[model samples]
Target: MAFEHPYGSYNVQGSLNEWFRVNVTGNGIPAWMPSAFIHYDFPETGLISGHSGHAFSLTHQGADPIQQYQGRIVGDGQRGTLMESTLEVNCWLSREKAGGAYTHRLRHMGDMVSYIFQSARDVPLTNVYGSTTDPENVTALIRIKPANEQPVLPDPNPDIVRRRFLIDYRWLERVSAG
Candidate 1:
């Protein structure tokens, strides 16, 4: 019998770009809110550089009057902590349904980690700080929007002080374009 390499040959060249379909859920998110997507452009050196680099863009595709809403991502190392587990990409979204711009963070903590840590599904009870970026995983958290402009429906109760939500990121299969 002839010997053969178990991990023979495969193509592994070019930039590491990816796309994700993010779903926003929670009482905090108004029912009228639309779905969002994130396009991550890996740096020349690839995923490693992307961790500390600014390379994300946002877009929305849904039925609504909102127009020309665009977003950009910037590296937010200052906002991150030493214990951070996911890559932190700060995103600024424009022209939300309620009529204004908003900022959020795309925690690029790989899929399994996000699920295990519940980073997007649940808010930490004890404020664990730190951040990191994964090669191909993500979750979203919206913050900094004023209490009045938060992505929530008009509430009847005056005592309600805060809103909660879960923004999840799912990897979209990549397709080659001619």
Candidate 2:
């Protein structure tokens, strides 16, 4: 059963090529699960906030290892500013159980970033099974606009045009697992 998921969004106003850091951590889940640290850059105007350019590093607990992925935001030059942008991310995940594998064609729209993680093995005597013991997906959306422009509603942060949308696994599905 597919459902419509709502993610967070962020709005940041500045010149193109500006750099930002996105930090992610695990909550209510195993610390050993994969987490990501992302550094992104806005290459130019008219490009979606997510599409600009960015680097990502995947980290896990109890292991002195990290895997890196780099991606770029490509858009049609003909499209004017405020146009929708599509981003494609290609990265690798390394885990004790799964080892290293490539993830390609993961697409993000606007400023939305989605992460799906699964356990390598499920615990016996439990509903958990297969490569993913309990699958979790988290998504974040970022919106960048002019500070002076008045939104339909009052601005939460008037200083900058930034807003973030966040959603987790619990919101997406009603499943109990360890």
Candidate 3:
């Protein structure tokens, strides 16, 4: 029931969860891993924290296909096609960044938080489909949301302190099955 975390050696004491199997793709690639790395491109008062593969989980907010009306009617009286899908990314960040490993973790957290707030660019999320071993990359472009504050979470390990950042990402279009 142990899942890998990008911070090195630490694993969340539970499985990757079942939702990933049904709603997600990528041979069990940890849902928390960012599709790719985005360097800091915005103004910030704090020191630049580097990046790493942080832990996160993705879940759908509503039905598989959430739709909205375009407010314009087509000739066929079709008012709705498809509404973009919303994904809730539960990301983990460490509040305490003093320890040796945590110091590196701090930088990773900063990079993510900064990107979330000033997300001028779309973050690409890649998942492996079919098998974890022979996984093929399936990509989806999504929006990163801003967090008002950091909320503390219970750390399974006695040494590390964990915080949860609930991130919202929406795909403007359906992910292509390329």
Give one digit per residue, the lDDT tens place, for model 1 in 30-82: 22233322343333442212222222332221112212212211233112111
Give lDDT: candidate 2, residue 85. 24
lDDT of 2: 0.22
Q: Which residue runs does candidate 3 get wrong by more than 4 Å?
A: 1-66, 70-108, 121-141, 147-150, 172-178
Q: What C-alpha RMSD separates each model from the true structure?
A: 20.1, 22.1, 13.7
Clashes of 1: 6
The candidate that achieves the highest TM-score relative to the unseen native structure: 3
Runs of candidate 2 exceeding 4 Å displacement? 1-23, 26-29, 33-35, 39-81, 95-178
Worst 10 residues of 2 by lDDT: 8-17
Q: Looking at model 1, report the run of 10 residues with the lowest lDDT sum.
A: 7-16
Estimate, for each residue in 1-178, the C-alpha lDDT of model 2 and write its tens digit.
5332222111111111112112123222223233332434332342212322222321111111122212211232221112222122222222222322111211221122332222211111111111122422232222222211112342343321222222211111111221
Q: What C-alpha lDDT values do all the predictions have?
A: 0.23, 0.22, 0.36
User: How much is the lDDT of residue 49 in candidate 1?
Assistant: 20
State every prediction's TM-score relative to the real structure.
0.21, 0.21, 0.36
